[model samples]
Target: MANPTGSSLLVIERLLRDRDGIWRQIIEERDLKQLTVQMLTSSALSLALYGAVLGASNGPLQAVSSFVKLPLLFLATLAICLPTLYLFNLVFGAKLSVLQALTLIMVTITVTAVLTLAFAPISLFFLITAQSYPFFKLLNVAILVLTALVGLRFLTAGMTALNDHQLKVASRPPALPPAVELPADKPAAAKENGAVLTAPAPVKRLSDIGGRPGELPPGERPASMTLLYIWILLFGFVGTQLAWTLRPFFGSPDKPFQLFRSIGGTFYADILQTIGRLIGG
Candidate 1:
């Protein structure tokens, strides 16, 4: 058996260096179980480390709480939103299997987690040097939002590629019958019920069907892409609300450490307030 750590490292390297190859594998349904395991392991570890950094602002206990909650936050959001995306795609004729959908989502989460982990050192530097709670909180929020956008971009690209590949395969012409020999005087025409029939026009490539090569015809874009966009928005809203529900990930220095906080205000309201505080001070 191969070492799991080495396998995961190779997976991550491939993710960063050869994302298109990964997408192809996903479309081909290759090594899905192994890919899922590697992605889950790497993302969980990365998010845990970043969560520890977020919690360190308060103390050891909060650090531990954050270390646990951080991974939970992302995974929980995935759990909440995964079903809607999968079902929506299915309703719109997507060829994705449940495992394929899950793996695709894992790709996004892994990218976000890894990017957040990359920003951990900068976050840690501020946690040590910066005293203002609002500044630190907003900075981390900005980082999370930025990384999540990047991950979502990857998700969108993967879905597009998958859809294109499926479309191409579907459009492909099957094996043609052997050409029937005819005398030099005979035309490739036949009389069908007194109506002359000629060989059907050659099938056009998908790229040539539309005005521009490699572009879908006007108003003929897959409904699944629109569904995916809506799902992305839904994912963002759900994640923010869930993060709010699982509050106190970053324990404020002024307040004593608490595992959870009373949920009264909205996440947006809190962000506006934080912005106000930072600007006012």
Candidate 2:
């Protein structure tokens, strides 16, 4: 089999062992196709895993819908959160290019997908043994939530690492002192008097003069956990909405198979009802 490219396999491996290095590549890498391929591969994996889990209760039909809905839910959530993240990062002075931001988000998606895939066998076991729909739904939901938490943790760590790297780059020694210019009127031998002619001291920019120690340079800042939390919340909101929109992944065994359930209530409401059933039992 052909090896997967950097965006998929290589980046994921790097994320596991060298998060900072992978993030640096995300910022510096010029090829966007690698990132795209990574996202697509990860999405495909997520679809398969979700299908397997949903297959437990809904059978083959719902498993097929899992092929569609799971990817849609994740991609949609990424699309919804991308702009907010880019803008917030810009405002905070970490101006990421659109591609860089997208790549970072894709990394998070890939991480989540990998984690979900890792749990697929357990889900399949549950499918065979547990006949309870509410239990299946809750278990799958818990799995997704755990995966999402891990993915978001990676995202935040990556952002922090990249921001710190940027700060270091920004703080590098000021450009070589401007070349010294000599006046044409002065004789080249004027220095024969044993006087030393030296370049005038370089003028420091306002940023260099005013920046506090350990603080980011002007118009530059590091990411904050506050922004990361907001992003996580936004992702969850979008994910829940997308899941509600693309319903019936776990159709009742008694009910007929369907791709889209009639819109009746919010995802949270359904979860609450499921919890009620689980507890009442």
Candidate 3:
């Protein structure tokens, strides 16, 4: 039998093994090069689709319209990406190629209509709310959900890429046995628990990853947690609508000028807001 002290030490190492080493290995194994290509291409395609739909629905545009719309088009496509990624990750724990994943998510969102229902009302409220009370408005939860969804796409692009790698390795010919056995030193039932240490918990020190200490384990999320996040964001924004009154910071009776009425006033308002934003930022 192995030395009692050595066996005990080995047991301790095995206990913390996955949280340290196995997790990092899974993240580093994804197809990063493919992922980068997928993100850029996916973003571009989604943008083109939005611009086309908008242009078709709204009206034919002037020659300069495309140029003016470039940014907005990108923004719309980004909207499509958010919930698509969320639900896609929710349903499938594994990752897919860029186009396959994007299309899959797009279809998923189209079928569920959750993003449509969620965003449309909130968007209408945003427009009306700003027109009604432009100043000192609270950042409600729907807005937060929208904001998080945008941020989430960026977050998950990295996540999907990381998972893609691990899934590939996991799909490979089985290199490790199932967790159904234990080492000889342990009791029969304990041995049946399949004690295999693939590798020592990663040496996560300055010399290991060049990162500071106490960093949380990276990319350690599950599908259910992501769904919970969406549900929370959904409720937060929708809750704002229930508030009976919204206090306004700007109460202008300047003949109730429609923001779309004057080109110069609209332009000036946008610029002032932009400058104010710079200061706030």
Highest lDDT: which candidate? 1
Better of 2 and 3 by lDDT: 2
Q: Which RMSD values do the candidates have, in order?
A: 5.0, 4.3, 18.9
Which candidate has the highest TM-score of all? Answer: 2
Model 3 clash tally, residue pairs: 8
| Residues 126-199 of candidate 2: C-alpha lDDT, one tens digit per residue | 87788777888899889989998898887887778777777777666667776556677874434636875566
lDDT of 3 by residue, 1-281 (tens): 64321232132232233222322323543433443333344433433333232222123332123223432433354454456555656465534345444432332222212222334345345534554322212222234345446434533443454555544453344244345444566554442247434423333343254433332123422334365356445433333322111111111323332212222333235436745764675
Query: Can you list the residue pairs that collide in candidate 1?
Result: none
Q: Which stretches of model 1 miss by more than 4 angstroms?
A: 1-6, 179-223
Give the C-alpha miss distance for residue 214 in model 1, angstroms: 9.3
Clashing pairs in 2: none
What TM-score do all the candidates reach, one by one? 0.84, 0.85, 0.25
lDDT of 1 at 232: 92
Kindly indicate the candidate among 1 and 2 with the higher lDDT. Answer: 1
Worst 10 residues of 3 by lDDT: 242-251
What is the model-wide C-alpha lDDT for candidate 3? Answer: 0.36
lDDT of each: 0.85, 0.75, 0.36
Q: Rank the candidates by lDDT, best first.
A: 1, 2, 3
Model 3 spans with C-alpha error above 4 angstroms = 1-26, 62-150, 153-281
